[model samples]
Target: MSEKNHQGKRTARQRLAVEREKQKASERRRRTLIVAATVVCVLGLAAVIGLLAANSGKSSKSSTGPVVAPSGAQGKDSLAIPVGQDGAKSTLTVWEDFRCPACKAFEAVYRPTLRELTGSGKLRVEYHLVRLIDGNLGGTGSLRAANAAACAQDAGKFPAYHDVLFENQPAETDDAYADNNKLVQLAGKVSGLDTPAFTKCVKDGTHDGWVDKSHQAFQAGGFSGTPTVLLNGKDILKDRTMTPAKLKQMVEAADKG
Candidate 1:
């Protein structure tokens, strides 16, 4: 081959080699970028899954609940948190849950009237504590708060503690009540409720069984939800004439009849 032609051919081959190397480097970079992006996405997804799993675990851990029976549970009706004379002419059975907002409202408005009637021997009130909110909302607040209320019953401060809890209730979705310490702190607001025995009962969930019994009774009563009130066995919510203002009148009529 001529010297000039040989030189040109060798130069062309070298240029082609350079181009191939460049292409190979480019491909490697592309693959590396794809792998890096995929790794980042996988890590982010794992973090989200871990967070969700941790939240679920917290909820599950709070669900096992306490074991003691309520101190105020009465005969044949083991769920009664009674607030009136033993043989009053009318029995106002109230099914309430601390986590329930409607129950809070009922307590805020009608509780005074009921207490007045109860205090005056005009009516008997059996407050039945229920915990359906925990079953529906996936938290321990309802159960824990109910357990705390039962502890108050043991200290002879149930009604007062009950009012304090509703007054200081967290948001419906919030699990603040799941903390036993907070419950104990709230108990301090009520007279004679924050004793060491009461504190232990609340922390250990002494009346969780009684709370469960109240729930069973609530369900067996054919009621669908909380704040279920009855006057001498008549469903108050289902009655058309039962207004918040007319509660006293209804009690009077029921008592007379």
Candidate 2:
């Protein structure tokens, strides 16, 4: 072969090799994009399913009751399970969701102190119920559990039922409270709570509307997270130095103020 022709053939082979590499890289990028899109689609679908499942507060065969707002309930939209005297020194408004694990922890740690203060007529707590987890993570437990607690309130057993529900709160992802029967079963553990009225209310989802309304209340209050505790309408957890004991002192100061 001529030297010039041989050199030209080698150049052609090098160009072909470079072209092949470019094509392979292009193919790899397309595959990566496709995989990324699929993952995004899957995550979106899961979030939608979660929201729908949480909002699906379908009632089964349970008891019936007047779904009127309980007496002393905060506003027309919220339930008021007040523990202390009406004219107490301080008001502790709690914005909590039933399915929030953090809320369960808050209850476990501060419930006793709360009860003590309220029982002693030094503080009155307004239990502001919200279903943030249901709205965020997607499950009906927050709604169902809140409805059950309202039912307990109807039966004059709010405190007992509320504590019990938190005590046995299932894992955040678990749909334990989705089953109305489970709610009623928990009520059985609370004296004077397992009754025909409570059963009817649970089955009919009588309080579900109020639960929805409470979520609206939480949003209107300019809050974004669960277990949002306000002592006399001031955020306390932001300090990170707040302990149960410190909280008591803070409330005392607020009361004096």
Candidate 3:
């Protein structure tokens, strides 16, 4: 072969080698980028899952330990705290969350009427406490408050203490009731509720599991929200015109029936 031709062929081979090397390097860079992006996505998804799991743990943990129903708790699974004579002709079932503002509002409006009817042996109230706000607002206030109320039930002072809780309910976003001391202090407002046993029960979360079970029952009932008020198995709040007077009239009608 001529020297010039040999030189040209060798130069062409060298150039092709360089091009191949460049292409391989480019492919390596692309693969590295793809791998790095995949890793970031995986880590992000893991973080989200971990956060969700942590929240679930907090909620579920509140209900851990024993399911001790309060003394004299009635209804299915002893979930309902009964007020007034069981033989009353009319029954009102109230599913309430202590941390829920709507529950507080309902209590504010209907408390007097409930007291009157219950005292007269015309209506009985079956109160089911739940920890809904703990799940939604990320706190233990609802659970703590419900457990404390159960303690009052154990003391035979549920009605007075229950009214006190609603009367002194904190803002929806405020978790003041989560503090055991706060609950005990509020118990002082009840005539004879702040005994040593009551304090211990509130601090120890004696009825947490019961409250959790009540909440689960609330969920299973497919109700929309808190302060679910039912009269004689009919949802009363669904009536747009519902008021304390309407409730009284309905209970009177049920009593007559």
Residue 197's lDDT in candidate 1:
94
Q: Estimate each model's TM-score.
A: 0.71, 0.72, 0.76
- Among the numbered candidates, top TM-score falls to 3
lDDT of 1 at 152: 84
Cα TM-score of candidate 1? 0.71
Report the C-alpha lDDT of model 2 over 31-92, residue by residue, as the tens digit. Answer: 34433333422343345445547766855222223345654566444455676788887888
Q: Per-prediction count of colliding residue pairs?
A: 1, 9, 0
Off by over 4 Å in 1: 1-67, 75-77, 254-257
The local distance difference test score of each candidate is 0.73, 0.72, 0.81
Alpha-carbon shift of residue 191 in model 3 (angstroms) = 1.0
Output the TM-score of candidate 3: 0.76
Weakest 10 consecutive residues of candidate 3 by summed lDDT: 37-46
lDDT of 2: 0.72
lDDT of 3 by residue, 1-257 (tens): 99999999999999999999997676455434433433322332333344547776465543357789999999898999999998899999998888776677677667889999999999999999987777665678989999999999999999989888889988767899999999999999998888999999998888988888887788668666667789989988766566677789988887888
Summed over model 1, clashes come to: 1
Every model: Cα RMSD to truth:
26.1, 18.8, 24.9
